[model samples]
Target: MQRKIRFNKAPLLGDDLIYVEQAIKSGLTFGDGTLTREVESILQDQFDDAAGILLTSSCTHALEIIAILLDLNKDDEIIVPSFTFCSTASAFMMQGAKIIFADSEIPTMNIDPQSIENLITPNTKAIVVVHYGGLGCKMEKIMNIAKENNLIVIEDNAHGFFGSMNQKQLGSFGDFSTLSFHGTKNISCGEGGALIVNNDRFLDRARVVREKGTNRFNFKSGKIKKYEWIDLGSSYLMSEISAGILKKQLLNSNKIQMGRKIIWMRYLNALSEWAEENDITLPSKPHNYTHAYHAFHMIFPSFETTKSFLKYMEDLGIEAISHYVPLHNAPIVLQTEKRTKELNLCPNSSIYSDRLVRLPLYYGLELSSVDYVIEKVLSFVVEKQKSKF
Candidate 1:
């Protein structure tokens, strides 16, 4: 029997062990320690326009920090792509904001600027954009809309860390951006994230929120005599061990990204002709944008076809899978009367949610395994087509 290829495995990049050991020996294993500060500094140096960087326990927490910094009020509305992870909207929801779901553009599967504009109302406070599969969203148009409406922009940069559009990094484009270092992401620290603040105005308040509503950061820097509860906040800091691992991953990001890029391109090359012939859709890259090659996905013509393909791959010991369920229509999203009445209103979100399939594209995935997956998928497509005839 052939060995099963898992969907994703946490990458074991060089220096992970070394740095982790160094962090342990340093004896500061808690939050806001040496490794955490080093990670933030490294990120600030790499990404242009970074006003400040705070390491967080997860990307979800990073987003929650943004919500706190914004001081969202009850019933304040936020526009978000319905195709995104639940955390994208949930962060704002936790702050008593109403989530208005927006549709995703077919090309990049990022939030549609037009849909965002349509969803906006006087109550709208912010527009949250997710950069799907490491490809940048239409930032120029989105930013323009945000500016005209005087609404803040937050980037759900979980998939696009270190990726860029038009020579500018994805996370730097928005007022605030969140990065994930979850095991499945391009880089892994098991569970870690960063909040990148582009505007300097929020730097002080952001620190307060990140340090549990206290003046701890100022106190530590000797700007203040001691720490005190100063504002609304949470325990959102990343552990020193996680930060140490992430530091190593951040330093080696380029190499890891290059490896994933090679795999992504190979999949595109192998499947493009087959996909076009079958009326299937492959991932699209817009001009002036560089993807981190975080994930490779295909959209089948129908839900049943996609289901069959996933099942076929599983039978062959390859773990192909689907991405997000349409968050707007999710059971959790619809449970409340107010939420249910709001309606998802995103037909395209449902379209892709049912038909898109994600292939395994991770750091340690072997070429042989990739080839096996490609062969199996192509075979499934061919057989399905023949049966149609």
Candidate 2:
């Protein structure tokens, strides 16, 4: 029987278990323990002097933490690409902010900055941009637009840790940003994340929010006599166990990144000819940007071809998958946004959502596995179809 390849496997490269056991034996398995603080310190240094780095339970929680800081009102709106994870919108929505969906641009599949400009309204409080696949978005343009309108910029950098644009770190450009240590990310702590407080004003509140609405951060740091509930927040803390594993991953990132780069380039080199012949789009990063190599994805000729490719790979014991269905078209949103005009607001997003397919890319994937995946991908052909989305 052919060995089955997984869609993703959490990277376990260095002292993951060693640190986990250390956390356990030391009895400091709670949040903000030594290992957790160490990871945050390392991230702060790496993220180009970010004002604060607070590790959270997950990236979703990281977004939620930012949401807490925003203090949104019902009419206050945030613009995000329709091509991103639901958390990108849902986090703000949970705080009663209206999400104004924007279309995605081709090639990079990052949010179209122009669409964001068009979507902005007087009620727009901020613009949240996701660096899809760790490829930096057009931050220079986006930041200028934000500055012109005085709108806040938040980087949903869940896929963009270690990535940079124009030699500057990606997450650092936004007023605030986030990092994911989820199993699927380029880095893994199994289940963890961090909030990068680029704007120092939010640093104090971020701590309170991550600590369940309390100023316990100051109390713990020996700066306050007593801690109390001072703001609206939640428990978004990552336990020391997860933080320990994350520290090891962070330490080994250079080696892990180099390995993933090799795999990504191999796929690109081997499949470029095939992709060109079939008009399928392969993953790429711009010259001035450094991709974090979270996952390698391709745009199939059609949704039918995407489905067919996934099925073909599965039959060969290779697990392949499609990505986010546009949140604008998700059933929950469709109930109120059922009108055809509203549904078509982000046409590029809808099209790209249907055609994108992701292949497994992780530090632990063996060289043989990478070659096997490339061989399987190259052998698959895009079937011509009259029907289109």
The per-prediction CA RMSD against the true structure, in angstroms, equals: 1.6, 2.8
What overall lDDT, based on C-alpha atoms, would model 1 receive against the true structure?
Answer: 0.88
User: Model 1 Cα RMSD, Å?
Assistant: 1.6
Q: TM-scores, in order shown?
A: 0.97, 0.95
After superposing candidate 1, which stretches have Cα over 4 Å from the reference? Answer: 338-344, 386-389
Full-model lDDT, candidate 2: 0.87
TM-score, structure 2 vs. true: 0.95
After the best TM-score superposition of candidate 2, give how far the Cα of residue 295 lies from its true spot, in angstroms: 1.3
List the global CA lDDT of all models.
Answer: 0.88, 0.87
* Model 2 ranges off by over 4 Å: 336-342, 382-389
lDDT of 2 by residue, 87-125 (tens): 999999899888889999897789999999999899999
